[model samples]
Target chain A: MSALLTVEGLRHGFYGVQVLNGASFEVRQGTVTGLIGPNGAGKSTAINAISGALLPQGGRVSFAGTDITRLPPRERVGLGLVRSFQLARGFPRLSVFDHLMLYGQGHPGEGFWQSLTGGRAGRQHEERLAETALSVARRLKLDHVIDNPVSALSGGQKKLVEIGRALMAEPRMILFDEPMAGVNPTLSAQIAEHLTALNEEGITICLIEHDMAMVARLCDPVIVMAEGRKMTEGSFAEVVADKAVQEAYLGVRHDA
Target chain B: MLSYVIFSATTAGIYGLLALSLNLIWGGAGMVNLGLAGFFAVGAYASAILSLAGVPVPIAILAACAMGAAAGIGATWATVRLRGDYHAIVTLGFAEVVRLVAMNERWLTNGTDGLPGIPAPLKSVLGPQGFAVFYLCLVLTILVAVFLALRRLDRAPFGRVLKAIREDQDLAGFAGKNAMRVKLIAFAVSAGIAGLAGALYAHYQSYISPDHFQPLLTIYIFLAVTSGGVGRPAGAFLGAFLVILFLEGTRFLGHLLPGLSSGQVAASREILVGLAFLLVLHLRPQGVLPERIRPAPAQ
Candidate 1:
């Protein structure tokens, strides 16, 4: 499969300390790509730069063969590339349904004047979006709490809301920043099942995860990052068995 | 006494208009527009100048709205990247600069002397008492229209985008929403509302000065929004009226305590207003009427 996203020579720093130093990788189309590294491996930063949330100091990011290095996050999303947060960020006061509806495809009554003086077409569009949102909620088992404010949701449920929001965008590729972080094991497995199900449906995904077992289960062509750069790329088992990947996670012993 | 009540109510209506605008930017979009007075001054002066130049009052007010929108968009564009407290400081500075320009630019603003004799709409035909009643009706009509329009906008997709941006701008951006454009439009509409209120104030009072567009007016509006409810349009309207009542009621203190100097009475009034604001915040941080999420339609 061809690469849907390509990041080369990605570099970033904060206050003179580098976080992402020449990180390079590619997420192939229709694959659940895993990005794993030790603490401070710049895994989050790498996805952020690729997602256009944080502009890298130096790099090239091509999405669907277009060089989108300088595109804003909104434009990137318009191109069908979307990302989720590590901690499930959302509008606190917005209900789960509204949150999903806010990210619906094709803004219908979104114009300044059109919103104030809404028409039959806008109402019709909204009704269709409501149905879509309802389906997404039902799929995620969030139908019961569809009208509950996002802040009132449990951590696991909020994580589901984030996924539901991404789904609402009808994205071609989704970069998830630890979607299962802080989630219980049962929900984590459910999220794993959802990711597998989504991958089967042809949506490309790149995920940053610390749960090695979950990563091993869900990811293919796993890319291991160490010291802000891609250390190795292979199947999960191959990367795990590599000496360099082991050393990166566990420091070299001076006594030996 | 009836006239006084009518006059106060009319002024409160103007404040309600201003409060509504502020609520859109501050509550809906999560922008701290401390330079609301700048937009107010821009609208008031634009209308006042155009009217003085023999333009029709309605046309002048429309021009003022345009100018206010331009000012709001320009100001927001310049400082959109500043986060949180920095944005507030820059907006505060913007208001100060506007005040200074109004103070120094005698060629346009007539310096600190200010412009007088602003022509009131329907003043000649209705006469004084009738005009007062007519003007009150006009202001109330405009306020209610704005209130209804804002409520509609708040329920539409536009308002949902604003709320998403307010919660987390980056998340909203990733949702394929242009947060910058949304915020710019929000600021423009809000500034237009403030501008409209300013024009109305100029016409009603038939006089306006830099003193009338004080930063203190912005603070009072903030207090009113906080007291009423942050995100609710009805809360802003009620809060404005409540604030005006408190402000006017304080005048009785000087009459009751004749021994107190006028300066002392003024100081005490400030203290009393501050105490009232604090009491409201202490009791209801969410305001008197917190924002309520609308219920979902039945599937």
Candidate 2:
């Protein structure tokens, strides 16, 4: 299968130390691709580079055959590539409804002058969008708090809201950064289920998770990285059995 | 007393316009605009110069808004890359630069001597006796129009995106929002409104100087927004009224206290206004009306 997203020689660094060094990987279309790495590994940085959040000092990222190396995150989103942050950053002051309403493309009311002139047609369109937002909330079990400020939500709910927000964009692919972190087991499982359901609906997912059990269960053709380079790419079992993988994690010295 | 009421009401209306603009930027869009007076100065000077040159008032007002928006765009463009306090500091400096230019360029602004005899166009149409009343109505109408427009946009996708931008710009961008672009629109619009207010203020007062457009004016608007409720339009409106009254009510202290001089009364007024601001911040940090739980559903 053709790759939906490809990262070639992704190299990035902070002021002094390099975090991602020549990290390269391929995400197959419509697959739940897992990017797993140990601490100080470049998994998050690589995801950032791929998502256009952090521009890589050197590398190339192509999405759906389009060279997006220089595309801003906003334009990348317009092209149906969306990402969620490690900590769900919902607008704390906005309601659950506003969260989803803020998404989508070419909202009729986005422009000040257009909204004023849009009149009844505009109001009707907005009603339809609101109903859709409400239905989406109901699907996510967030209908109960649809009118409440995001600040009123629990951590797990916030994560769901984040995912819901990504869905609002009608994205072809979602880059999730630690969606399972700081979430309850039940919600985590629910999230896993939702992700699977979404994948079943033909949406591709790239997940960064510390939950190996989930990575094992959900991800296919797992890609592992260490110190900013792809260590190996294979099935969960095959990658685990690799000697380099063993050395990177355990630091176990082997004599020639 | 009637004249005082009309005068006070007109002043309050102008301040209300300024407060509404600031609230939209700082409160709604979540970007603090410390250089509000810069835009206001730009609008005032632009309108004053245009009208003095025999340009019609409407055209001059529009020109003022255009100049103000241009300045707003310039300010945001220069500082868009900065975050939080850095943006604030840069804008504040922008206002200072405006003041210095006005002060130094004696040939244009007439330096500290100020521009005098600014025509009150309303007086020409409505006649002088009821001119204050007419002027009051005009400013109020504008305030209401701006408030309504903001209220409509507040729920629209633009305002909703602004809310998102305010709370979390990066997340908003992640959802495909052009955060900077949205902010630029908000900043420019807010600045335009403030510029409009400055034009009205210059014409209403019939004279303006470099000292008229000061950081103190910006501070007053900030005080109004904080007191009224940061993101609430009605709160901003009410805030302007309350603040003006509170500041003006202090003027009565000179009359009440036998020993109090005019200068002492002025000092006391500042103290009281400061105290009220601090008290509001302490007691009702969200202002009288907090940001509402329910936003309009569509946006």
Candidate 3:
């Protein structure tokens, strides 16, 4: 399968301390690729660079074969590349339903003037988007609290809502940062299942995760990183069995 | 007495508009703009100059709004890249600069003397009292419309994006929002509304002066919005009314206290305003109208 996203020689730093050093990876279409690393392994940095949150000091990011390294975050999102936060970010004052509706409206339809004029096509498009958002909320079991301010939801529910928001965008690819962190086992299962279903429907996913079991179960090809550089790339089992990967995790020593 | 009440209400209504505008930038979008007076001064000057030069009143009003928007856009361009207090400082500096220009630019603004004999709006058909009442009605109508429009915008998707940026800017960018652009638009809209209020104030008072648009005016409006409720339209109105009442009520207190001179009473009144704000902050930090948490819908 052809890759949907490609990153090469990506390097970034803050205050002269390098965070990502010549990191490279590829995420194929309709596949779930796992990125695993120890704490401070630059997994999040790599994801941020790909999502256009931070500019890399040196590198190229191509999404759907188009260079997007220099694009602003919003433009990148418009191109069907999106990312979810490790911490679920939702409008504290807005209703959960409103959040989903807002995400749905992100699809280009009505400009400010068009919305003011009440254009027939724009209204029709908005109605459809709203309907789809409701359906997605129902599927995610968030319909019960649709009108509640997102701040009122539990942590796990917020994560699910974030996923719902990403889905509303109808994105071609999603980069999830620690989707299972601080989530209950039941919610984690549901999230994994939802991601699997999304991937089956041809949405590419690049997940950065710490839970090895969850990563192994969800990912087809897992990429390991140590100290801001790629350590190995292969099937989950082969990657876990690699000596370098094992040493990186447990720490290796050299004696005279 | 009723005339005085109406006058006070009209002034408070103008302040309500100012508060709402500030709330859009400072409360909704988490932008700290301490230069509101500068933009207000711009609107006032723009409308006053244009109207005096025989431009139609309505056209002058539009010009005022455009000037306010331009100032807002300029401030946004200068400080949108700066975060937090840095942005606030830049805006505050811009307001000071605008005020200085108004003070020194005698050719256009008439400097400290200000423009006198400015025509009251709708004075031909409605004489002084009638004009005052007419202007009050007009200002209130505009306030209601602006208030409802702001409420609608708050419920819309665009407002949601702004709230997201306020909660966490980094996450907002990650979710596909251009934080800077969203902030700029918010700032511009807020300034436009403030400008509209300033235009109304200039015409209602039938005069324009550099002294009218002081940094203290901006602080007073901020106090109004902050005390009323930082982000809500109703809060803005409530806070402004309360503030005006406190400022105006001090005049009545002088009658009860015969020994205190008028100047002393004025000074004491300023102190009272500060105390009143402190009391509100202590009693209700969320303001008179705290934000309500909406309950989730049933499955």
Candidate 4:
């Protein structure tokens, strides 16, 4: 399979405390690759470096064979490399529909002067964006609360909205940071299914998930890490069976 | 008496415009722009100087707007990298610098003597009293245009993204928004509006001075923004109108306090304005009209 994302010798730290050290991995196109690690094993740091959230002091990140290590996070997003937060960031005062609308691209009506002169083309653009926003809201089952403030959303619903926003960008790849956190089992399962559906439709995904069972069910070519370095890579069963992976997870019995 | 009411209403509209401009920065973009009076001064002075140099009134006003936008963009370039309170402090200092320039640059601003003979378009056609009425109408019309522009922004996708950035800068970036560019555009546009209001004030009064753009002017705008509500254009206009009413309403205090001097009444009115803002903050922190997020009903 062709690789869509590649990281090499990435290193980052905060205030003299190193979080990611010489971490490298590849996410192939059209697959959900999982990154698993114990606490402080640099999963988030690695994702941050990849997504341009934390510009690494050393190492390189390439997307679709182009160097993007120094690109600003916003520029990276414009190139269709997007990322989501573990806590599911949302503007509390904005409505769910507004959150979705904010993510709509190619609308000149969002410009200051263009907004004043919103002609036939602008109105049509808005109508199209509205349609897409509606479809996204419905797909996420957020239609019920579409008019409500984001503050009113449940934790699981916020996670879904976060994903919905990423989808609005028409992403090529998404780096998900613990999207399953704080979600009920059913909702989490639905999230996994939605991700699988996305993968089937040719979107590359790299997620940092703590739930090993969900990871085993959803991700192929699971990447494992220990002490901020690559430990192993294989199918979930193969990685879990590896002695190094077991010891990294403290004999693999502690979690169960 | 009716004319006097119109005069007061026109003044209120000017304040409304000023308040709304500041609201764009503080409420929409979550950036505290404390140099409001600086932009106002730039507009007033640039228009005054240009008109005195024989430029037409409309052209002078446009130039003032450009000058204000430049100043706003310049301020952003200098300090946009600074986060939060630091940006606020730098903007506050900016207003003081403009005031000092107006004071020290006596050759242009005429120092404390102030600029007289500021041109008005209708002054020749309508004559003094008729011009006053016509000017009020003109100012109100400009306020309406400004109101419509700001109101549109309040509901537009651009404003939504601004609020998004206000909530989470990191996430806004991931949403493909160039946060700094959005902020600069919003901030500069706001400052340009403040400049427009200043030009109106200068032309209406037929004079301009440094004291006219004092930091207290910025304070009054902050009060208007807080009292009317944040993030809503109507709130900015409403708060400014109410601020004028509360201050002007004190004119009737002569009957209630027979022994009080007009001077005393004026001083007390200022105090009352301050106290009313404090009370509004304590009782209704959201202003009289709180922010509302426009959402299309789910179909």
Candidate 5:
């Protein structure tokens, strides 16, 4: 399959501390790619640079053959690139149903004039979107608390809602930043299932996660990063077995 | 007596609208905006100028709202990239710049003397009695509409994204929300509402000056929202009412204390207002009407 996203020689830093150095990777279409590394391995930094949250000092990022290295985060989103955080962020004061509807409304109905006088068409569109969102909520098993504020949701539920929000954007590619962090076993399974299903439906995913087992289960190809650079890339089994990957995780042994 | 009560209530109602706008940015969206006075001043000046030029009242009101929205956009452009204290400082600077421009632009704003004798809406049709009633009803209607719209927005997904931005901006960005754009919009809407209130004030009072759009007025509205509950739309109304009541009710106290001069009474009122604000912050840090904490829906 053709590459959906390509990053070449990406470099980023904060206050003279280099976070991502000469990182290179490619995300294939309709595939789930897992990015794993130790703490401060620059996993999130790579995602930020690719998603345009942090501008890389040097490198190229092309999404579907378009250079997106300098595109703003919203522009990237407009181009069907979306992302989720390790820590699920929801509007605590907003209802779950409203959350979904807002994301759906991202397409066309949010303009001031449209919101003010879009009239029955707008209302009807919102209704249809809400209905569709409710169905998605049902699949996520978040149907009952649709009207509840996100603040009231458990940690895992918030993660599901975050995923739901990304789905609402109808993006072709989504970057998952530790979706399984702090989630329960049951919820983790549910998330894994959802991701698997999404991948089956031809959505491209780049997941930054610490859980190797979950990454192995859901991701087809795995990329490893160490100290702001790409250490290795292959099947999860191959990458885990690499001596360099092990040393990167466990540190250099004097015996070796 | 009824007239006085209605007048106070109507004034409070306009202030309530202003507070609601401020609450959206400061309380709901976690933006520390201090340029509200600028937006408010623009609305007041725009409406007053249009009315003096013989424009119809509805058109003048629209002009005022447009000016207010423009001011909002301006403020957003200035401070949207800034964070926390820096943002607050930029907004404060913008308010000062606006006030200075209003004071110096003699051709447009008539300098510090201000434009007076501006006609209220429907004045010819309603006369004094009818005009007061009509204008009060108009202002109240707008307030109600704003209240409803804000309430709806507060419950919607857009509001959720704003809250998410408030809690963790970086995370919100990852969640496909453009945090800067959202904050900018929130700031603009908040300023627009404040500007609308200024327009109403200009028409009702039939006069406006740079003095009328002082930074202190912005601070006073901030007090209302902070005391009422920062993020609650209803709290904005409650806060405004409480503020006006506290300020105006003390007039009776001045009358009771015959020995005190008018100047003394004014000074005392300021002192008391400050003290009351401190007391409220100490006692109910979240204000009188705290943000409603809705539970997560049942599984």
Candidate 6:
């Protein structure tokens, strides 16, 4: 598969504390790429830079042959690249269906005049989007609480809503920042299966995860990051065997 | 007595329009527009000036809306990056500046001497009593139209996007909704609504002054929104009327404090409004008729 997203020399800092220091990587078109690193290793910062949540001070990020380094988050989403937060964030009082429908593919029926008039075309578009939202809910097993406010949902369910929001965008690639963090093991397994199924459906995913076991099970060509840059990349076992990886994690020098 | 009642109702309708405008920015999109009085003053002054310049009343009213929208856009652009308390403070400052300009700019706003005998629309076509009733109908019709438009907006995708942004702007942006553009449009539309209300007020009263568009007026509208329901149009409409009634009802209580001066009676009314606001906030923080949307039926 071709590279769907490329980040070259990404450098960013917050108030003089450099978080991402020349981190570079590529997300291939048809694989679930795992980005694993220790705390403050710039995994989340890289995702932020790629997703347009924050602009990197120095970097060139190109997605699908277009330079999106300066594109705003909304425009990036329009180009079929979307991202999710580590913690689920959404409209507080809005129902799940409303939440899903609000982020519908291409933001249909959102024109100001069309909204005011409620023309037949807009209504038809809304109905179709609603149908899609219902199917997404059913697939995520969220149909039971589709009418409930997202704020009232369980943590795991809220995580699913975060994924569901990305799905509604019809994204080609999704950058997830710890989607399964803080979930119970059983729900984590279910989330793992959902990610697998989505990956099978041709959506590329670059995940930031701390759960090494889950990363080993779900990710291909896992990229290990340390000290704000890519330390190594290989199959899970191969990277695990690297001395540098051991030293970065265990702080023990493995002289070979 | 009947005429007084009709006049009060008309005034309430005008305020209802203002409350609706406030609700759109504050309740719909989570923007605290403390400069509402500034926009209101812009509309009133724009219409008054145009009408006094021999321009047609209808055209002048439309121009007033445009002017108000311009002010909204300008204010939003200037403070685009400010949020929460910062936004509120900046907007409050903007309103004060507008009031000061009206006070000092003698050539434009008459330097607080105020504009008098502003032409009332359709006044010459109808007798005084007939005009009052006719004006009431006109205001009512406009209010209903605005209310319906806002209701349509509440259920529409535009409103959904607004709610999304209101909840989490960054998340909304990730969802491909342009938060800034949406906010600008919302502000312009909201300010235009305020402007329309102001023009209607000027025409009905046949006079307007800088003192009329005080920050206190903005506070009253904000109270109406908070007490009724923040995000609900019906709540705002009813809240305005309810607030006006409260202000008017205090008149009867003034009789009980018979020894108080007229100034004290006015002060007591303000104090009463403050107490009522605190009571509502303490009892029903989400507002009397909190925002609630019925789920769409199963497909």
Using all chains and alpha carbons, the TM-scores for the candidates as numbered come to: 0.94, 0.94, 0.92, 0.96, 0.84, 0.97
Q: In model 5 chain B, where is the ten-residue run with the lowest total lDDT? A: B290-299
DockQ of each: 0.75, 0.61, 0.41, 0.70, 0.25, 0.74
TM-score of chain B of each: 0.97, 0.96, 0.96, 0.96, 0.95, 0.97
lDDT of 4 at A146: 90
Which ranges in model 5 have alpha carbons more than 4 Å from their true place?
A: A15-18, A38-40, A143-148, A182-190, A250-256, B54-58, B105-110, B120-131, B145-172, B178-189, B254-263, B282-299
Off by over 4 Å in 6: A250-256
The whole-model lDDT of each prediction reads 0.89, 0.86, 0.83, 0.87, 0.82, 0.89
| Models ranked on DockQ | 1, 6, 4, 2, 3, 5
CAPRI level of candidate 4: medium
- Per-residue alpha-carbon lDDT of candidate 1 for residues B1-299, written as tens digits (9 for 90 to 100): 98999999999999999999999999899988898888888889889989988999999999888988898888888987886789888888888888888889999989899999999998999998999999999999999999999989888988988988888887788888888889999999999998888888888998888888889999999999999999888889889999999999997865687688888998888888999999999999899877888877777
Distance (Å) between predicted and true CA of B106, model 3? 1.1
Q: How well is each residue in B91-208 modelled by candidate 6, as lDDT tens digits?
A: 8988899889988898988878988889998789897888999999999999999999998898799998888888888888888889999999999999999998889888888888
Deviation of model 2 at B255, angstroms? 3.3
Supply candidate 2's per-residue lDDT for A145.
87
The true-versus-predicted C-alpha distance at residue A171 of model 2, in Å, is 1.1
Worst 10 residues of 6 chain B by lDDT: B290-299
Cα lDDT tens digits, model 2, A1-256, are 8899999998998987889999888999999998887877989888888888889999899999999998888889988899888978877878888888777666766776766555665667677778778777887999888888889999999999988888878889999999999998899999999999989999999999888789888998889889989888999888778888877753432321
Clashing pairs in 4: none
lDDT by residue (tens digit), candidate 5, B100-206:
99889999999999999987776877887777777779888999899888876765445656676777676565555678877877877888888788889999989
Model 2: residues >4 Å from true position, as ranges? A119-125, A250-256, B122-127, B295-299
> Interface RMSD value for candidate 4, one decimal?
1.5
Model 4 TM-score, 2 decimals: 0.96
Each prediction's number of clashing residue pairs:
0, 0, 2, 0, 0, 0
Model 6 lDDT per residue over A120-182, tens place: 888898988989999999999999999999989999999999889889888899999998999
RMSD of 6: 2.1
